[model samples]
Target: MKTPIIMIAMLSLSAPALAGGDMPVKTSTEVAYQDLNLATAQGQKKLSDRIDIAARRVCKLDNSITGTRIRDRDAERCYVAAKERANQQFAAVVEQHAKGG
Candidate 1:
């Protein structure tokens, strides 16, 4: 018998505004799916949905080392980086879940 696989996805950030700087804003979201069966389309879709939500959530707020000028690319960069990380993470774990490894 094989054990159920649990997927825990998380994103987080924190920054404190220094003197004469914008207030640092940071946010993180963690999503967990219990007994996820990535072998099925439904399971894969759910995981993808969770990752999208998490990416948007993590990049929704702007965070800067010095709270300097915030650019749109910053959010896009964050989103892309987060999505890549999620894909890598899920790639390994999802395979395990699918094959019951």
Candidate 2:
């Protein structure tokens, strides 16, 4: 039998624009953990790492040039918010898996 895939939609970037624009933009990615043995610490760490990678991609802004302190600040804020939200979801999933859900 094939292992069931557990995917976490790591983030949806509807936060304040990272480009310092009034318009809001959205980006998202899913992290899959079907192959991971969540019963082990290593597996959990890998899941967390995957979420971090996805969150970074979803929140990234081209920091090359893009002169302006406001834009830089916005980008930083976006990454923090994205990572926080993803981690929250990650915690919930881990808890659920521990309970054999």
Candidate 3:
């Protein structure tokens, strides 16, 4: 009975360490993805800048562009595109983390 009790206590003490220590640390890419996810707002802003540049080029190529209309349309498109891309990137990060990649 004493032996059994000691064995049980030892197993209980070592269980948590085994579970935690056996887990692998995140890789650099996984860490990068996590950092990007944490800074999603900043990522969105950067993506928005790229979208704005593209939309501005498009507006410039079109002769009928009114400044206000072009700005409004470009802003709307940029927001939507930025949001979609950000969401895709967020999903990729989640997948990478899940896969331990």
Q: Evaluated with TM-score, which candidate comes out highest?
A: 2
TM-score of 2: 0.68
lDDT string for model 2 (1-101, tens) is 42333333323334445456555555566777888888889999998888767665666644454566454455567677777777777777778789886
RMSD of 1: 6.3
Superposed model 2: Cα runs more than 4 Å off? 1-22, 61-63, 66-71
Per-structure clash totals for the candidates: 0, 0, 0
Clashes of 1: 0
- Kindly give the stretch of ten consecutive residues in candidate 2 with the minimal lDDT sum: 2-11
Each candidate's lDDT (Cα)? 0.63, 0.65, 0.37
Ranking by TM-score: 2, 1, 3
Best by lDDT: 2
lDDT at 67, model 1 = 57
- TM-score, per-candidate, Cα-based: 0.61, 0.68, 0.31
**Stretches of candidate 1 above 4 Å error?**
1-27, 61-71
- Per-residue lDDT tens digits of candidate 1, residues 9-51? 3333323344446655555556565655678889888988887
Q: Candidate 2 overall Cα lDDT vs. reference?
A: 0.65
